[model samples]
Target chain A: MDERERINRLRWRCTRRAMLEMDLLLGEFLERIFPTLGPAQADAFIILADMEDLELWPLINGSRECTDSVQAEVVALLRDVRVK
Target chain B: MSNSSIPVRKFDAVIVGAGGSGLRAAIQLSEGGLKTAVLSKVFPTRSHTVAAQGGVSASLGNSEEDHWHWHMYDTVKGSDWLGDQDAIEYMCRMAPEVVVELEHFGMPFDRTDEGKIYQRPFGGHMSNFGEKPVRRACAAADRTGHAMLHALYQRNVRANTQFFVEWMALDLIRDESGQVLGVIALEMETGEVVAFHAKATIFATGGAGRIYYSSTNAFINTGDGLGMAARAGIALEDMEFWQFHPTGVAGAGVLITEGVRGEGGILRNSDNERFMERYAPNAKDLASRDVVSRAMVTEINEGRGCGPNKDFVLLDITHLDPATIMKRLPGIREISIQFAGIDPIQAPIPVVPTCHYQMGGIPTNYKGQVVAADGVPVKGFYAAGEVACASVHGANRLGTNSLLDLLVFGKSSGDSVIEDLATGKVAHQDLPENFAERTLARLHRLNTQTGGSDVNETRLELQRTMQKHCGVFRFKDMLAEGVAKIVEIEKAVARTEIKDKSQVWNTARVEALELDNLIEVAKATLVSAEARKESRGAHVRDDAPDTAENPNGRDDANWHKHTLWQREGSSLSYKPVTMTPLTVETIALKTRSY
Candidate 1:
C-alpha cells in the first residue's frame, strides 16, 4: 500500500477502540499527533493499533513500563494525550 | 408476486433470538421431537444473556426459610400493582422447579456449605411478606446468566436444535387470516433473504434498552421482535415502563449488578452516608430497582452526588472481605477496574442510573401466546423474555427475577406449542400472495436511495431525544415535546441510507435496518409515557408526586391499565391489568413502599 493509504487506514483503526476511554485517548492522539508524524513514528503508531486493549492500555496509561524501544515514542505521545 | 423468488426454509418451529429464553424454548421443542430452527444476530452464547450478571431468583430455601407466597408478594409489590396477578403467581410458583431443572442441565451454580445452590439477597425479594430481606436469588457467583445461558445452549445442542447464527428476522410473516406463519429473515453473511416457514414462531428477542443513548444493552439489542410485531399491526403493551438499573458504572454505562449490594455492598453519597437509609428505611439498599434508581437520581439532583460533576453516586464494597469479593462478584470487580478504573476490593465504584431493561413489549399471556388484547390470542405466535410483557413485570422488574421469567415462560411456551401441534391442527398456512414485499422494498430503498439520512446520526438523535425528554424523571411539557420530536425523527429513520451495498458481511446494512426497529421502540416509549400522567413504578413523572394522602402517585382508579401503542398511526389504547390470581384472593392495593 502507498504511504498515505497506510497512514489513513491506521487513523481509521484508532477510532475503533474497544473501550470508550481508549476511544477518546486514541482519538485525541489521532487528531493531534498522528498528522505531524515521521515515517518511523507512523510505523510505530501502526503497530500500537493492532495490540489488544489489555496490553495497549497499560502502555498508554503508564501502569506498565514500556520495554520495547519501537513503541516508546508513540506510547509517550499516548500518555501525554491521556494526561492532557 | 411470485412466491418462488426468495429461498424458503421449513421447520416445525422457528425461534428468533437465541438468548436465554430462546435457547430454553428451543431445547424443549427439540427434545419433544419437533424440528426447530433458532436464529440470532450473534452467536448463541454471545447473546446479551451473557451480560446478565446477577442470579435468577427462586424460593429454593437453600440459604434460609423462604416460600413461593413470599416471593409472589415481593414481586406484586415490586411491580407497583401493575403486574398481572395471575402471571406473577404462575412465575413465582414455577421458579423453584425451573432453577432446579437448570441445575440438572449442568448449570454450575455456586453452592452452600451443604452443597445446595447458594442463594443471594436481591432487590425486591423479601421474607415473611416484605418484613425482611431474603436469600432467594440462586447464583453461580455473579455470572449466573453466563452459566445459565451456556448450560441451556449445551442442552439444546445435545437435543440437536438447528441454529442459524448471524441471521436477523426482518418481519413476522402472517397469513390472510392473521395467523403468524413464520418470519422473513435476512442472512447477515450473504445478505440473502429467506423465509422460515413454521408451524409456530417464537420471539424471544431481548430488551430495547438501546432506545436510550446510555444503556446496559449490547449493540444487538435493537428490539427486533417488538418492531416486527408492531409493524404487523399488533399493539405493544406497557411500552412506557422501562427499568433504569440503579448501578451502571458512571460515564461508562456498563452494568454493575445489584448482586454486589445483595452481597452486603452499600451506596454512599458525597456526604459518605448511606442515603438509601432515608429513602427506603426498611429495605435500605435492597429496595426494588425503581425505588433505588429514583433515590440515586434524587441524591444527584439534590446536590448530594459523589462525583466531581455531582452526577453520580458511589457503590462501596471496600468493607467486604477480599475473598468474598472475588468469590461472589469477580465479574463486577473486573468491570469496575476495566470500565470505571476502580478496584472494588479497596475503593468504591462510581455508579449512576442507566437504562437497563424493558419491562414491557409485545403482550402475551402466561402460556406465552401473543394476545391481540386480554383474551384474544394470536395463533402460532408466541413471545417470552424481555420482548413479551406477559405482564409479570408490569411497571418494574425485580433484580434476578428477569432470568426466572425467561425459564418459566420460555419452557411453558415451548410446552404449549408441543401440545398445540400434537393435536395435528396446526399445519403450514398458505402464505399471503407477497409475504416478502415490504422487506424487499425496504432493502431496495436502502440500495437505490441517493443522499438519504445517515443511519448513525439519526440513531444518535433518537437516543439523545429520548434521554433528554423521556429520562428517569419525566416532565409534562418535555414528554409532550418528546412525542413530537420522536415523530419527526421517525421520518428521518424511515429514510435511513447505507453506503455499503456489498452482499458480504454488510454490518452497515444491518445497522440501518436495526435503526428501523429502534425508532419504533423510541416512539412507543415516548407516546405511551406522555399519555400516562400518573407516576407508577418506573414511569415516574415530576407532576405526579406521592403526597401524604396518595402514596406512590399510582392512579389505579384511572391509569391501572396497560398502555398499548400501535405503530400504524401512532395510536394508543389501554387494557386493564389482571388483578385476580389463580386460587388466591386479590391482594389489596396499598402504598407501594419498601
Candidate 2:
C-alpha cells in the first residue's frame, strides 16, 4: 500500500482500545505525524500501535523509557506533538 | 416550563453504569427482546472495570481438579464466614458456566496448550479443601476485566443495546407505594436532564473505592448507585468492609495485581524475608487479600518494611524469566515502571496496601433483587456487580471474585428481569406526582447556589479522612472520631457550591455532584465501621488483639451477621447470613486460616 493508505490503515487500528486515553494519544500521533514518517519510522509506529494501552500510555506520558531506540524516538516525537 | 418539566423517556429496563455488569446485563436484556437503556457517566469502555488487571475466579478445573464446593468454602472462609452461604453457593456454582460463556463470547483469554481457557492461582483460591493453591482464576494475560468489558460491550452493540453515554443518574424515582419507577439522569454533552421510566431499574455502578484518597479505582467511581440507593431508603450492607490490595504501587495507588504472585512473584521485607510465609505457611503470598494486606501492614508497622523510611514492602519478580513477565504481566511491568519507576524484570517494585474494592453495597438477593432492610425485595428495583452486596463477599472479597461476581450476577439479574417481564410480574407503575421535584431542586441548588465550599477541596478532605482513620488498621477511638468527622464533612458537602455554571460539559458541576455521592459512601463506611466492634476480614480493628483461637480476633459469636446501614437517622441494623446452601451441606464456620 501507498504511504497515505498505510497511515489510514494504522489510524483505524488506533480506534480499537479499551481506553479512550490511549485512543486520543494514538489518534493524535497518527493524524499529525504518520504521513510524515519514513519507512523506518512507519515500522516503529506499527510496533507502538500493537502494544497494549498500559504500556503505550507510559511511553506517551514520558514516564518509562522504551528499550528499542526506534520505538523510543517515535514515542518521544508523539510526546512532543501532544498539547500539554 | 420549569426544571420539574423535564422530558421522560421509557425503556423496558434501565441499567445505570455501563461497565462490565451493566453491559453484560444490557446484552442479555437486549438479546431477550427487551428495550434496555444503559446510562454511564463516561463512555462504556472507559468505566473503571477496564483498570482491573488480574483474572476472574472460577472453578473451571482447567489446570487441576477443582469444584464449586471448594470455591464456596474458600469464599465463605475468605469473607470471615460473614457471607450469606446461599448467595455464596449460587455464585460458586454459576462460576464455570459464566466463565465459559464469556470465553464463548469471544473474550481473548489466555489458553492452555490444549486450547482450554488458561487459569492461574489467586489469593484465597484453593483446591481439595484449601490443601494447595489451585489454578482457579481464568485469565487473559492479567487483563481479564479489560477483555471481558470489551467482549461484553461488543456483544451488547451486536444485540442493539441503547447506550446513554456520559449521562449520570441523579436520583432514583420512587413512587409513594415504594416501587422504583426509574431514574433522573443528566446528559453531560447538552446538560439536559431527562427521566428514564422503566419497568425495572438495575444499578451496576461498580464500587466506591474512591472513598479513600489512595485507591486503585478510577476517578469516575464515586458510588453513584450506592448514594442513590441510600437516599431512596435502601440499606448499604457491611459498609465497614473495604478490601485493601497488598501490592499497590507505592505513593501512587494504581494497582499491581496479585496475579504477579500467582505467577511466582514474592513479597519481601527489608531483610529479604518472605514475610507471608510467617503469616500464612501454606498459601504464603497467595493467602486471602485481607490476610496479605494485614501482613504487609504488620511488617511495615514493625519496621521490617523494604523501602525508604520503612513504609512499604517489595514485590520481587526478578526471578521469573523475562519472557514470562513480558507475556503474562505486561501491564504490571508497565505500571511498576511508570508509577514506581521499577521494572519487574530487573528489580523489586515498592508496594503498599491500597484501597481496592468495596465488599459492601446496597443489599440484594442472589437473583439481583434489591432487598429492603427487612429482607423484602424492593419492587421493580435490582442491583448487581460491586454496587450490590447480596451479602456474598460479606466482610472481605477474595481476589478475582469481584469480576466473577459481576458476570454471574449481571447475567442472572438480566435473566430475572426478562422472566419478570415475560411473566407480567413487573407492574408498570405510573410516574408518581413530583417525582422529578427533589432531583430538579438539587440540580438547581448546585447550579444556582453561590460559593460556600469548593467541590475539589471538600472531596480531598473526605478522601483524606477516610484514608487516615478508616484504613487497613482501625482503632476504636479513631473510628469514633472518624464518624464524627464524617458527619461534619457531610454538612460541609451539603453547602458546597458549583463555581463553574456552564451548562454544557461542565465537569465542575459533575464533580460537585459526585462529591455528594463520595461523601455519602464515606459516612456509611466510617459510621458502620465504628459500630462494628470486632476485627473481621478487611474491617480489622487495631484495638482487638488476635487470640489463640480467633484469627484477627474476629468475634464471630457477636459480629457474624451483616451490618445494614441505612440513611434514615444513620441507623444500623443486622441481617442473619443464610448459612444453609441450596443443595450441599453448609460449610460450617471454623477459625479461618490460609
- On DockQ, the leading prediction is 2
**Best-matching candidate per lDDT:** 1
lDDT of 1 by residue, B1-594 (tens): 245799889899999989899999998899999999999876687677765667899998988899998999999998999999999999999999999999999999998889999988986799999999999988887577778888999999999999998788999999888899999998865678899999999999888888887677766678999889999988999999887877888766777777899999999999999999998999999997767888887787689998677878999999999999989998777667766778899999888888888999999999898889656878899999999999998888898989999999999889889988998657788787898888888888888788799998999999878876787878899899999999899989988887768775666788788889999999999999999989998899888988875577778788889889999889998888899998677876888876
Which residue pairs come into collision in candidate 2? none
Q: Write the per-residue lDDT of candidate 2 for residues A21-43, one digit (tens) a residue.
A: 45545666777787798889889
Q: Write the per-residue lDDT of candidate 2 for residues B362-398, one digit (tens) a residue.
A: 8988999988878888888999999999878988888
**C-alpha displacement of B583 in model 2, angstroms?**
0.9
Q: Where does model 1 exceed 4 Å of error? A: A1-84, B1-3, B246-251, B256-352
Where is the poorest 10-residue window by lDDT in model 1 chain B? B42-51
What TM-score does each prediction get for chain A alone? 0.79, 0.79
Give candidate 1's error at residue B85 in angstroms: 1.1
User: Where does model 2 exceed 4 Å of error?
Assistant: A1-84, B1-4, B256-337, B340-351
